[model samples]
Target: MKTQSKKAMMIGTLALMLGTALAACGSNGNNGSSADNGAANIQSANGAKGADGAAGPNGGTAAGTDATASPDLSKHVKLTWAALGDPPKDFDAVKARLNEMTNKDLNADVDFVWIGWGDLDSKYPLMLMSGQNVDMIYTAGWLDYSGNAKKGAFTELTKDMLDRYAPNAEQKLPPEAWSNATVDGKIIAVPRNFLEYQDAGLAARGDIMEKAGLTTLSNLDDVETYLAAAKEADPKVVPFNTGASVGDYPLTSFVTRKKALVSVPGLPANMLQFDPLETKPQLTSSFDDPDLLAAYPKIRDMFLKGYINKNVLNNKTPSRDAFKAGQSALAAYGDNQFRDAYNDINAAHPDWRVSFQSFSPEGPFIKLAYDSGMMAIPSASENKERALLFMDKFFSDPNYYMLMIYGIEGKHWAYTADKSQIEVPAGSDPSLYPKWQYPWGFGDWVGFNKPSTTDYPDYAKHVEYMRSAAKDNPYANFKPNIDSIKNEIAALNNVFLKYGGALAYGAVDPDDALKKAAAELKAAGYDKVKAGIQKQLDAFTPGS
Candidate 1:
């Protein structure tokens, strides 16, 4: 496990302590239909049903669960989930309606502590370190779930606990989900059953692309062309709303697509890369790679030409948020970021015609880590059992899960006539109640809904491609035991952050910066950290 500096720990602890009370207050409400009429009503109400005539993601039953089936729900409780993203308008009303069902069925009311994308890194560590009263928080491979689990920040969920408290999940979730959640022979989190492409791409305004006479962004060159045209078309908007702090560098996709390298999960900036197709791929550093060096000049050229924000290093706004707010012409990030950006931007400005262009549109897409998005109980949580029960309902109960993601149906969202997808309700401003995109922990392929079909058919197509084409990650189960080299890793990470962003964003001379960074990293024990990771990798099996 990694250790924090004395100064960082002190500051993080203080920040979390100060925000503990308000964190629980960041809550949203959702409404649920009664079990007796839910399935029938869903089926009869304008043909609003699932992919099949049935109601759930799978053709199981209707949206509601029988409240009386649970003999354990004798006392009412409240759960606080530390989730990502800002709550939409009417969140309070939605929360009230959602609590109505939870109160009836699980005898619990849930609150979400909204953590913005910009604040996630700093705040998440603080919450865990401070032992905040949050019952559950989002966890993933990118968020260092295994590292934190080893550090004793998360509760060790036993098989018996899962079978008893979250029976539906234990029974319905695939074996891979459980195995993915396991670290050091213990289940540390409840893994999301959904699979997605773990690749980066660009989200741009199709309307602007049309103005530029460009229809597609197939490669980095196309991205540059689009960025130039976008700026020319609208000088008021920044071409690319990217920053260095949150790893929002524009060249991320370029490196990934050009090299066809698979990123090592849980690493800083995914700096470690390897060829998955190689039977015994060796770990390599982006800093030392020739491809990264080659891309730096192109990125620097874009930066020098005023394509990116001049003060990006100090900017903390998330790239997607900047795009949605109309402050930037394009947002560059991952598949999930594209989905959220498309949903919100399309809702806010249907005329703008938002679209996503995958950096790797051909082959080499990798399967997302099964635990890429999950809900983990914090070690400090007082309501571990109740939290597990909530997970059970969120994953199993369609009505509850829908509420968590889409809010109250009529008020927040509406289903299509065919009942295969969702759409904005008539006369409702989608921007006001953008689909609740932050319930990632509850995202099960068996219960989730695809929204906004009218304005963005590409999103649906991309979803299909991800499910069908993405290959499983060869090192999905290889969680490196960094305990021995945690100090070296930390030092190397600091070296990268201090110099990597400058090189990536074109704020410094590539030649000078690269040499300086390489020297600093080597001095900081980069080789030792790499060896530590490789040692663990060599001893692990891919699908064992």
Candidate 2:
């Protein structure tokens, strides 16, 4: 979630490094701050109707119209939204508090539908394709946002709609956020304005480390040492309890340690690689990386030594949950996930010490793609205006935003005395009312975002380090139009799963599986896909 006060701080920090981002076209030839020109330009570009035309969805005035008049809040309406993850025990309380504001402001109430992590892959598309009653749903780059948008699953957002409904967000969000969310020249979702470093790492029990006399984990070898020690100390405990769905320790290690390769956006299974340092954007098959090949043996060794679970391919439980339940000694995931693990574990077992270590502590940090998290409305939604209006509160009102993110303050979490930081409240059981996994469409910077309070010291330190170390990714806004190579991408993805999955999981020797996988990928049209992506990359200008 993004907070209003933090905008200046983030902007100031980004100003020193992130130079001017690529502004969205039709942005009045500048940043998208001037609503007047932006709306008119969008009207021309989208061919939206003017004021005299039929009303837009939810009985709202047509786009490109004079929207100075306030919306009619006389009629009470109910909206249904779908967000990621399981709902907390105090969800009713949080929703009730949120509706109080919406009821008074927009005369609307909302029902939040929670979609668990496992269901997201199948359910997101089903909800859209089935024409469900969901007014809004959480979407992201990894969730096939462009694919869904192309399928007419989402509404095309115009600047007039934002200006009239979500004025605060329309004014505050940087141009890059909108530019990145644009698919085929239509803004499909509202991109979160928060700056995030989506780097990978592992969390370990600090208490165990102290007892074993182990040093801080700085690299892969250190992690292996800690895992081995933990395994020796307790043979029953799975040292690394991770699964195939999210990510693996091997890829995270190579990425941060080597600092040369990055996962291509929208291409999972490490099918394609991008080098941000390249003067011209480049994409190559991950199978060709020599460093990755060298690392496979190390991962295989860990698998053979019983440090990682042999049934990792079938493991469905999130690593964080396993870590908290005392099922594992090492929890491997992105750096951002450590906060939840720390919060839950500290709440349950006060004596336990949890800490996170980046595989590479310095260098090679790229900020997250702006569209990594977003709020999107389905084409079936009849309350489109109301949904936008509700989302607007997240940006316009800090209290509403805070309540949505942190829950009922004292009951769920509390701010420190100085109000500069957040911390768990006394006697609160974090597991009973977990932090909302989906921050929705906002990040703290745009006044739409996430906020968390942890008793763990390393939590705050990690955030500061990421903020200081973050670098601009030149291709952050470049979204490859995979529509042309959909068949090829699908085929290559299957090859990665059948062959690359085994190699990545350390189940097979790279010597045998790697060549077979490369051969299969070529037969599946890997070259055509790579060339198509490269062509798109060549046409992209970072700050155009």
Candidate 3:
């Protein structure tokens, strides 16, 4: 695919600026003094100096040396890694510290490029099309990892290459993780080892639940009872605050064994639902599904009965903000969001405790593929070997990993009294020096240490619960080739954008909305896409 001229011009300008910065900082120098000396200093401090005078973590070889010596590509090469979100105010200081360790240990410098979430969809394609100088990039299934891999936007990381350059990553990550990262038998990216369960559920204000005499939220009926009690406690407070953009399908579909049909992210209007127990999976519409249709009217009745916010269809404010302000009693969220939501709500209302209950607490937990968050090498990289070395070090070395995730130890955060947990300093202003960390893109969850500030104290236990309970998606490995129906997918997506949210929110009559959506989908050639998907599914051999 050819790049747009405008994007090419922008990339050229960025490359020029980066080149100038590298030259001014003298980061390209080949002298091995800093790296060699730093390694020696660490060895002396740890008293791990070997008989050959080489120093390293395990006392095997010097910092950069191993059983297989790393290639001498340390000519001060600066690699750029792109990730989503804005850089912190003190990003430069953090980058400098990162360079200090990397330059010394791996003879490399890395520049992080932060792309705002809104701009990523547009920017990523441009960067790939232009063959931008970025060596490493953060990608995910949500970001169209499969599409990009198929389009040759990322380098295919062979097993031998990984063994040579990133052996730590290969060995530490689970075999299932590698399988998730593989596309057409080629590993296109390194999956971040952090595990998270994304089952959808409700978070309610504990104070409200207690005042209402509600003990636990086990099922939809229990949730309704809690919401009703919350309404009785505070007549002004909305029992449940929902928005047009947020889907209530998950909240209602919890009891059903059949999954709700929804558009796949990045692929847009192509929709599918699978029965986990079914040997031969088939795509079907939620609108036509009896269970989904039955659930919608009940939610709509709740909205009409003042149990849900009156302005839910038009409310633009996020549910978290509404809950924090005491405007809402309960909000729908994923299992992973509970801890963060609890912390945020408590920060605003210290007296108000927040509790989350998973809608799907039993077996059949949906296991997300490791490619949910990953770091991929761009095919345009000039320093692939050096990039791999840096990644290996980032995951293997605890000190380097910590620095990369959290900023300078004493500055951004400090250890608790016993040095068992991380915390902010007593008098430091957190606003001035924001702690910016991207755990998803960084490999090696084994190296990750959670800060004590997280509201869920039993996070490890929760992870274990999910591990033993959750079941993998039967069609996780299936990747449908949508090249033939691209235009139809786009058209169907446009139709969905116009009608899907309204149906999800129960903002319109279910029968009317469903008929309209179904008709439009058919007019947009949904059958062709369905046929295409079916063909791929038929050809797929389970566990092949």
Candidate 4:
């Protein structure tokens, strides 16, 4: 009787393991619908829906009681985590410290894989194709999230799995974030819970703004006035140095107004403009907009009047470099870029105070939550549950998150005398302890420590301002599946690469350039791609 009882217990344990394995590998059954045959439809809406997965053998329970229950400290597990960028020289040391904590708290260790920026495009795809033993990966819209999701490269983060392993994170993440992460009604990634307002504008020399007799630069006229002052002040300095490309600053009309659908690059046929005030959103070509058209001539005038660099069409020098070298007075900048510019300029030229000016009177522009950043579990991972558990700890536990981002507290960084902020110790060699400030890619922003007072005096105020005044894109959660129009998109990109920069910089005649680009786009099946986009837009119901 004793032997029989032991045999029954062993069989039940084996069954449970088998069941868990099967559940992890099962299909999510939410492959998004494909575009209908013919002109691909393009409509404007928000959000996609995903189907939930069936409960696993352990019966999805609360935080600690699920089938993949709280990790067993007695048994050890190791996971492979891949993040973008070059590995730090002290990576092994950091990993050793990280493992010490993880082993004690979660009974697991992580083998971090750093994919350098230059190698990501090639390496990531190969890993997915070869079904490498990678567990978690840093992914983002700009980093091919849509493409990888479509290819089943990432696991479907079902509600049950989330509840079982990352209940706190599931509840902490905003609804909009989940909506953005969903593809074909299945959540394929866990987006970081960070608030970032990427309002685009310009950074200029403070002396130039004062010399231009301008207190504020909120519009194109103000920008022109500032440029003129800088030119008059110094003949050697380009008033507005716009590097080799025309850049997105020229499309301030679209960006500042939030009229453009900021989809992943190479997907849209043209700059698809929309009216945020409209009850019903519609996609229109910026090339066809009269207001947008007017900006082209103005750009041309600036180019001709010598307000902008004459060699701007193919200038390889970065605007920041030009500023450092005293070759440029003004450069296009995003909100955070201004801070960096200020720091660099202040370090180099203490007498020259650098300041930033926003073009949009509407304040900061809020990007979609998912656009902030995300980490995803690969579909090929056998240790999905362990990975999810680690993610939860990374997001919810300040110690883990801080350790991963800033490194050892006393060694890599130290608190200020008042303990209100953190900073490197005096006389410490930074190279010995590299700080990877990639919170958006690894963990929740809510867990991040407050910035040191020395870094930004008004850090708290800035956060409050962004929370209160930043405007979200009305179409923030819209996800268009453009598999059918890939060929057309490729063709459009080629044409844009050849002629778009010239048009953007006013280096070419607008009328002739626009007509020729339009003609070529049509030949490349632009209309068909537009239709397909319209179809997805029409079918989409925001937050449905």
Candidate 5:
């Protein structure tokens, strides 16, 4: 039996202090379909689902879970991986292919365990506490990955282990990604390295924009312009689509400093100087802060004016569909979602011209914090080395990786003549599409599809635009020892859940919301959380 890791312990302690309160407040599955786990699904609502694996690549070469000097990796071992979102449609079929690889190379096999979206946060922790022999876990810093790492829920994979077993994974990821995975200078989890260009923008209905006498959607201010344009052009349509409680999952991917008001409540209490590198810092309430106070009426203004969907508060529409079917004229989401939405629209309405705008023209338009792509090894696994090895293959094995993420050839996805753009088969149910959760793929170095995107000149143009607007995050390495402010985070977030949307959409009275938000922040121990974080930052020098 493998012993509990320090990371798990810390996570447990913090969760004990924090998670319960959060659960009480509403971490309720914000998923539209009682099944959506807040995980960002960038692909269209239902383009082509990612295909299943056919006797795939990488694992067939290794044999066994031997961390010994001689490394006897030939023994067939069963390892378990747990994650919250849906897997590829070909998960079972792909599992067999991966098993075949393990049989060939490492002489090992894997057991796939899935946790439904609703049960993930609560159930995953209980499973870990029960001492289940899980080998690897998928984690994003924002999604409790680093918190669990700090709690000793995962083992540190030393350079020695990487050199010995998973060299491909080590080599494929860039230093930036690997560096982010380090806690106390030890690598505890794997950053799913998929290519990413951080840019938060808005997706506009090309047809609507044309009808509205508009050339393009560019800024937050332009939101009203587009809304008016869409409204004047068509009488029975909502100009924009937004949800009251929806977490900005996809938008966070492109923006630079997306601290959640719920995820990190203190956005209103006092201005906590957040570090760009260390994304795991426990945020304090900004509810009382002047800047945050300003955001309240801003959001309310939009809500009152009908710039957004009237039913936004109770909206359950799959984001892109609302825009595609002409229910809404725009979607203020992430660049990836925007791009993928464009693809979906093209597949369905091949005749329409579509495009989106970057985070507003007036700064504060975006910030990218923790990525959607993150995975961690479990502290309870007996075959961690082997688990990491398989993961390394998953990361480095492009053939298998693409097949797992994008789907099969000529069936679910078809390549353009130049093999640049991929198109999903017509009328494929969006639900059938795989969730791509085997391991979250962030825009890491591992997935550069030069051939896959050759024909999509627009995608290239978008990448360039994103590149120009993208800012290198400065605090990617800062991990707030939230051990001290654990309880306060949940409380603060509860208060935030009450006010976050009012400000974002100009729905609530700014002064009144600030009063309630500030009062609650103090009650929730905002000062203590800030001081804890500040002291840590003050004492440490960056890169020391």
Candidate 6:
């Protein structure tokens, strides 16, 4: 977020941010930050507000301003949106823009209710049952996408409605992905599209590596070398710092050689959306896998050698922040986190260099089943037409996309000499930066407006470079029917919780942790999930 308020700059920055957030998907089939968690039916933050056109059951009343019966949308419509941290700097301006656009595009008015960062899931569920009449909502598993779909918190969109009203959004998406979003054959959510893959990877400080006498880092060996160099250069800093939630990374990076670990989501042999495969309709969850067979030992070794920062296990600070502080050499994360921290690192470490790698092995990654981020129609909305129109304009209107993302161009940002770069516009106050998150719905990769009269390097090359490095996990669109194994899924998560973290974090003996978890899963119907997935895969063998 920058101080300017140009729409173009906002959109471009938004795209960059989204690309980073959704980099996992945009990069081919990986997620940059596990934070987006837009995986499979995870209701995305940017949901649909029904588009304007012919209205049917989802339409409003004639007593209101709608063409037919006017239902007094301002009175009846209540919407709730979920998000991280506080709203952006120009949040009011953005909402004003939305209200103005709503009046222009449709004849209804509405408001966006916000839910804070505090314990979202527990609170969101309460909100759902409160009968508060929320018109649209943001959801994910943590926010309960699957749970809510089952609980009937959202209204399902009829296919006819999508085609007739939201043809633009419907046409833009890849087909099978749409199929995965249906609950009992009803489209309950709007899927989020991203540019990069969502898989985990590494973020290394170039300056630290340079001092460590390493120019490139493709493996843990390089990381070790870099850490040693950093300590030698400045003993004050811990060469490595990690979150308790992410301890698995160092373990995985060491085991995989140069690749980042993958948590595929399908049955055995049939990879999930995260896998690299020509054919497969399944996903794999590496979280509980023995790949840690190697990962555990390596990470344990690092821990013993004091190669990692001493405060890692207790460090509640964000990994990206630690990197930005130059307290660590490598930050293990996805493309999403790296981007959020990238600018800061550049600013803080102007003399430093930066690069990334994955913690998974260098070869034969798993295929992930379909992953998703969603937007949903709140059962509470009365102004569906206006809401839909807003989204349509939001994605399709170049100007709106730009405005929502970058703010007013000349005031928010300026293009470089070659018109290749977007920097904070001159004379803008960095403190009052306007924040716009565009990647919420639009894909990670897109060109809002080309340079009119300049020729810098191809800014689009970064897109090309990432695309070249990507391979869609053929199973990216497949999702299994988990109704039969729903209970088991919960039980398994509990079991994994008990021993999984211990194993991944090396908090407990690896052998004991794996044994306990495997045994617990086995007794709790681990095979049931595998079989359930197998049954679906067999049904779609043609794709396999």
lDDT, candidate 1, equals 0.62
Taken over the whole model, the C-alpha lDDT of each candidate is 0.62, 0.60, 0.56, 0.55, 0.48, 0.46
The runs of at least 3 residues in candidate 3 whose Cα sits more than 4 Å from the true structure, single-residue gaps closed, are 1-80, 85-96, 106-135, 159-164, 194-196, 211-213, 218-266, 302-317, 325-328, 331-333, 340-344, 378-386, 404-408, 411-437, 450-461, 472-474
In model 2, state the lDDT of residue 223.
66
TM-score of each: 0.82, 0.81, 0.72, 0.70, 0.69, 0.70
lDDT of 6: 0.46
Model 1, position 191: C-alpha lDDT score: 74
Winning candidate number (TM-score): 1
- lDDT by residue (392-466, candidate 1, tens digit) is 777666787777667789876788898866777878666565554556654444445554554345544555554
335 Cα displacement, candidate 2 (Å): 3.4
Q: Which residue pairs show backbone clashes in model 3?
A: none
Model 3 score (lDDT): 0.56
Per-residue C-alpha lDDT of model 2 across residues 387-466, encoded as one tens digit per residue: 98888777667777677666788987787788765566888777655544445445334323334545346544555565
Positional deviation of residue 141's Cα in model 4 after best superposition, in angstroms: 3.9
lDDT of candidate 6 over 1-544, digit per residue (tens): 0111121111111111111122222211124322122222212222223234223223322242323233233533323343332355666665676557556555544465654322231345666777676656654322335546766777776655454445455545444445545656666766544323344456776667666677566555676677678777777876666543321234443443233223223221111212234344343443444454656655556655666654443344534556667666666554444443354456556687565554442333322222345567666665455455455454457666656555656755566678654566666643233323433543312334222111112222332334444454544434456667777766655554354333333444566656665777789787787677667755653443
Higher-scoring candidate on lDDT, 2 or 6: 2
Name the candidate that leads on lDDT. Answer: 1
Residue 279 local lDDT, model 1: 76
Off by over 4 Å in 2: 1-64, 73-75, 210-213, 247-251, 254-257, 260-270, 350-352, 443-455
Q: In lDDT terms, how accurate is model 5?
A: 0.48
316: Cα error in model 1, Å: 2.4
| Candidate 4 lDDT by residue in tens digits, 1-544 | 0011222112111111011100000000000010111111112111222223222212234355454555445768889987654455676777898899878877888897765332333566678768988989866654447767887899998877887777656756656567667778888887755534444445577787888888767666777787888888987777777543212233233232434234332242133434433466666654555665777777677767887776654454545457667877865544433432354467677666776555453543343445436778898897898888888886668788777766778877787788656677776545554444443444555545445423322323543454556555666566677777778876765555555455455566788878987898799887887777767766766444
- 3 or 4: which has the higher TM-score? 3
Query: Which residue pairs clash within candidate 1?
Result: 28-95, 29-94, 29-95, 30-94, 30-95, 30-97, 30-98
